[model samples]
Target: MIRVIVADDQPLVRSGLAMLLDAADDVEIVGEAADGQEAVTGAQQLQPDIVVMDVRMPVMDGVEATRRITADGFSRNPDAPVKVLVLTTYHVDHTVHEALRAGASGFLLKDTAPADLLAATRAVAAGDAWLQPAVARDLLAEFAARPDPRAPDAGLLARLTPREREVLVLVAQGRTNVEIAESLFVGEVTVKTHVGRIFMKLELRDRVHAVITAYEHGIVVPRKA
Candidate 1:
């Protein structure tokens, strides 16, 4: 079972999320918190597989809670750190970037479809990053507007083979492995291999990090809308 803790300042929001997730046979709502500090405490105590966090909260915020939970390795296994999936009503660009930087595995709008929420939670629990296409596009635009201060490590890009770099660019553009395979006229497995190599070479934690790296290094730019 995928254990989860739902955190939101509003009782209705927390309860609603719990109810939706509880209906899934493979998912269990292990706990709930009404604020960010409580969320962090709950994560440390429960050691859930994932935390469904709200971006804004009283007495702390989702970003800090996520950072503490992830940094402290609040999970059943230390090596496999706990995952956080941030949910917000607004599409505030800085909040999105901060949540990901604080180790959130995914970002979703609170109004996301029930099925999509379930899928996103499951994906994050399974060690994947999930960002809606619209969210990814917005994030890329935000990054383009205000580039990350840290300079891209040139050696990291130099380490990737040409195929891996191609894969990385496609991933930054939000193409799935299957889509990339189809576009490149290669098998999905080949795309996955290239993706894995790209992650290893770039020291990326997941696809979200890979996307950030791509933008940071100018491998991909936000396209004109």
Candidate 2:
């Protein structure tokens, strides 16, 4: 079963999410919190597989909660690291970016379809990253526009092989592993291997960071919309 802790300041939001997730047979709502601090405490105590976190909260906020929950040595289950999926009301905001940098595995709009939200939670719990395409594009554009963003680390990028480099570019372009496999005329497993290698070689924490690094390094520039 995929254990989960739902955190939101609003009681209705918390109850609604809990109800929706509880309907899934493979998922269990192990805990619920009204604020970010409670979410962090629940995570440390319950050691759930995933935390459905609200970006804005009364205490501490989701970004700091995510950082604390995902920080090394905080989670007792090191083998199965607790993943965070942040929900936000706004799109392409700084809080979303902060949450990602703080170790959130995915970001979704609160109004996302119930099925998609469930899928995102499951995907993150399964050690994969998820992001709404439009949000991701806008977020990357915002990041790229920042003044004096860190220069691309050519030395770190040099660690990747040519194929891994291709994979990273595709990933930055928001292509899923399956799409990348089909596009490259390779098997999905091959694409997965290439992605894993790309993450390892680049020292990326997850796909969100991989995308950020790709943008920062100019491997894939955000297209002007």
Candidate 3:
């Protein structure tokens, strides 16, 4: 089972998230926390697979807690890292970006459907970044609007082969592996291999980070509406 910790300042919201996730066959609520500091403490002790974190908790914000929880696992066991799935009432622009930058694995609005929430939890626990279409669009727009975006890591980009760079661009474009394979006239396994290489070479956490890198480095700009 995928162990999870629900963390939110509001009691009802915390209970609701816990109940919603615990009902899933593959998930179990191992713990709950009323604030970000408590959430970090619970995560360290319980070592859950996922943490459903609220963005604006007292004592410490979710972003800082997320940073602390994920920081320790950076050079440790990648397979067992405690992934965070951030939930918030705010629009998916600055908040989402900040969470991701702090090592959150997935993001969703608080009003997300129960089914999508479950799916995102599962996805994050299974080592994937989950960003719904709306979130992705808003994030991309936010990045595009930056008058001076952070420059891409020159040495890292230089490490990618021409083909890997193409794969990264497609990934940033929100293309699935199947679509990328079709577009490149390659097999799905080949596309997957390319993606894996790109991640390793760029040291990206997941596709979300890849998309951010692609945008920050001017690799793939948001398309004109």
Best model number under lDDT: 2
Model 3's number of clashes is 0
Model 3 scores worst on lDDT over the 10 consecutive residues at 143-152
Can you give the TM-score per candidate against the true fold? 0.89, 0.91, 0.89
- Compose the digit string of candidate 1's lDDT tens values, residues 115-190: 9999999888766678876667777777666666553488878999888888888888778888999999999889
Stretches off by above 4 angstroms in model 3 are: 74-76, 145-152
Off by over 4 Å in 1: 72-79, 150-152, 185-187
What is candidate 2's CA lDDT for residue 151? 34
Q: State residue 104's C-alpha deviation in candidate 1, in Å.
A: 1.3
Clashes of each: 0, 0, 0
**Whole-model alpha-carbon lDDT for candidate 2:** 0.86
Q: Write the per-residue lDDT of candidate 2 for residues 87-167, one digit (tens) a residue.
A: 999875789988887889989999889999899988888777798775777888765666224433789789899989999
Tens digit of per-residue lDDT, candidate 3, span 1-225? 999999999999999989998998999999999999999999988888888999898999999999898886542466688889998887644766778788888799988899999989987776666876666776776765662244347788999999999999998887878899999999999998998888888877777678878887878887665
Candidate 1 — worst ten consecutive residues by lDDT sum?
143-152
lDDT at 10, model 2: 94
